[model samples]
Target: MDLKPLLNKLEHYRSEKPNKVFTMYLNTDPADPDQQGGKWRLQLKNGLNNFESYLQEDGDSDEKRNYWAVKEKVENFMNENEMNLKKSVIIFATGDDDVWFADILQMPVKTAFFWEEEPVLDQLKEMQETFPKTGIILTQKDQIKYIDADLGTVNETNVYELDLDTEDWRLHQGTHKADSNLGSGGGKTSKKDEFYERFEANRYRWYKSIAPKLDKAAKNHGWERIYLVGESDEVNDLESHMNKTIEDKINKNLLDHEETKVLEEVL
Candidate 1:
């Protein structure tokens, strides 16, 4: 899809009164060192690196270089670009306490998930009451899905599911297939095929049922931008496919499809 128009829109949004929005995907865990948390820190670092490069080329000579320094630089960049954090909406999807830092630092942020052990219903109620402006989402593995139905019609939420073959689906099952060829090869093939077909069919039905709800939620909440984080390769692939479908539909309708752009944190 042509992204120039979307880029222009984002530019306009950023310039038209400095509406700054920050979506921070946390990758660090305070308790686990061997988990994916460490890897997320690296991603954040890479974003910091990118920011540093931008600063060296276009920033002032006295720019700071420490952690807080980088944070200041980021804030400065937003200011320079006419992004107003107070007017912007910041979303965070985090599993650990790293998100608390942003709040502790008093950053203009609104968190989505903080990995609480509270019951889903309780959490939902609290979120609705406490963070009325933030969106409430449900995360399955790496895929982020919206699950708020009471606020609007079920048709408002957007659900997208990927249809995969037996082999692909099996990979996500986190199990190894037994060596059936040496034992019960004859009946296994047909059974496996049947299982896969059933699974794929069900997956499609569920996803199709859910996506529109998400779209409706976005509209009801007045969220101009939708961001997806921590999704798996399958979800990412599906998103890309959906974007193409959207682009095609928009083109057919004589409308413009704005490409979604992500600004990675530069280290």
Candidate 2:
């Protein structure tokens, strides 16, 4: 998920009263031993109670009422998304609903709570740093797949296949039609060899043709880092053609792997 707009909003937030914003980061990972019996529920309950009890003792009536309103909202959100919980949940809200942000993230987070004048964004900023907006280009032969990701999750995917007829790449959709020109039987091997030889001869030029397209994609999608994954020669040739600085290159063909597994292997 993109955090630029959200971070900008939170950074500029201003509440009429002190401690008006409520921020929460809860770890609800089921695999964690500390969370084995749905322990996050208990933690949530206790955390909310602690804030309410403290407000009851020292806060004015308005403060107490606002806290209660935010508390109820947070509880309702958790209840609605309880079944769909990921590794963690984050929220930032106010009594008047002037600012409300909530997300269930695939990555884990440290559990914490805060009632302050502005949103708590330390953890969020750290996550953004660790997993910034990235573009993963998986290239193999005449095909390329682009994976756009942010904050450790996939946002969009696109595939491009080279059109030998035009010597240019085109965005591919649905089932790709098989090549009808590859000779059958004994001539199949010869046709395949000839095709490979032609591709090898024009490899640099073909990659150069699409370099600008990839650069545009990175700019349009706000990719902070680029990764090229494929054979060493292909990756090196593609990197040489592109103007964007590649964060890294993996000499492994992962174009046909599952998205999740590819992420695990690359990131």
Candidate 3:
């Protein structure tokens, strides 16, 4: 896509909301791209202020530390911006329970897509029941397709689906193409690579079909800024992988826009 125009538009918007704060979700999974090599820590070290840490001696301590560290950074950012406690957007990954906590705290909540798992669907259904007004965004193609099928209709009035490529925003660079990497198992040597290759390919296809819907949802929400906390590259490597930049995409796609700040760990 031609990104220069979008970049310029985002720059204009940034000039207007110099203090706006946006948040991104991070997948707390230790092996998630956002958590590898403690990259999220480095990204948040000096930026967050209000956060809670999980203290555990088991192998799960790392996970707890990561979650608390991010919470602290986000709290700090919110304080610094003096975000309207009621209007601030809190972005969460698919698996974080904190998403629900943020809502209880009275902060506005937004989420990325959760796929076909019945467990996740049940969780989503519960969340929707609790926060009927909350904004839940979807970017996975398969999830969108399933939702559309189940709903038996396409409603652009409230939800959004964008036409961008999910791979560009989700997968690590170069992992999408076919090669020997396609089926070589990374673990347990029995067709592992092949399994991952197929998995990656399927994910890529699904994302492509869903990006447009996500774009529409983001635009419809008229969010002033976006905050993300997740393991996916769309929430992690957004600045580098997507040529237009997050700030720009917000300007082009979101409403009442100003700036986009991502508080996330390096994936």
Candidate 4:
């Protein structure tokens, strides 16, 4: 959810009198008690109708027609995406389609509507303040996962697995792959001890090798904050190696968990 371009556009947008921009922030989260019994459906209906009624009384024919055009588009958008709704839906539109923006957001928003000459952006700016672009780095013994998120929704995920044979961290498209075993014939405890000792000895070097990669990713994705989650020692080691400032560190191994669960736990 890159907000820069949208914010810039909306900030500079202004219409001559009689042409209004319609802004809507609808809370459609099913988990909310206030939204029980599909209350958002009724809210949407009334909100649009209320605007139409107000326009009919005080606005000219062009303004009424403009409101109707935007209203129809808003209704159609909601109808098509209702099944895929997340916590909220936001829309900024105009009758002539000179400016239109709609998104289903994982973060909840206060329901509000406005018909004005310019887009209403106070809520959106507040949301950006609350849920800035963030990067979550999950590290284990030999694997690292990066979750890039904006406005509380994951935008991309990248996985890097250390190739023991080549002693290099290789980027993979998705999450966990088959673990590289330590020894074929050995007591489990003994093998685990050996692996731990070996990793502890070279952890700094391995983390240092990947520090630049994380820095690059942060810059590329414009991560406003970075979080490191793993074993305490591992997290500390990685943090020390990275040049980027870490917003927080959680001493929990979450590489095996699903991405959503990882976010819930660490975020």
User: How would you order the candidates by TM-score, starting with the best?
Assistant: 4, 2, 1, 3
Q: What do the candidate models score in CA lDDT, each in turn?
A: 0.32, 0.87, 0.31, 0.88
Residue-level error in angstroms, candidate 1, position 79: 29
Which digits, one per residue and each the tens of the lDDT, describe model 3 over residues 1-267?
122332243333321111222234322233445556644444444333222221233345544555455455555654564433322223332123322222112222233322111112333334333432212222222222111111111122222232234333322121122133323335547565554565456654544444454445445444323333222533333323222213322112222111111111100
Q: Give a tens-digit lDDT track for model 4, residues 1-267.
A: 898889999999999757899999999999999999889999999999999998889959998888889999999999999899988999999999998899999888999999998999999999888788999998988888899988778888888877767778988765545465465565877887888898888889998998899999999999999999999988898899889999999988887888777777766
Instruction: Give candidate 2 misplaced runs (Cα > 4 Å).
Output: 16-19, 173-194
**Model 4: what TM-score?**
0.93
CA lDDT of 52 in candidate 1? 53
lDDT per residue (tens digit) for residues 1-267 in model 2 = 899999999989977663399999999999999999999999999999998898878858888888888999999999999999878999999988888888988778999999988888999999899889999999888888888887667778888888888987888643243344344887889888887898899999999998899999999999999999999989999999999999999999998887656777889
lDDT of 1 by residue, 131-200 (tens): 2232323223212333222211121232232333322211122112223211255677777676556544
Scored by Cα lDDT, where does model 3 land?
0.31
Candidate 3, 21: how far from true, in Å?
32
Q: RMSD for each model, in Å, please?
A: 18.3, 3.1, 21.0, 2.1
Candidate 4: where are CA atoms >4 Å away? 175-193
Backbone collisions counted per model: 25, 0, 45, 0
Top-lDDT candidate index: 4
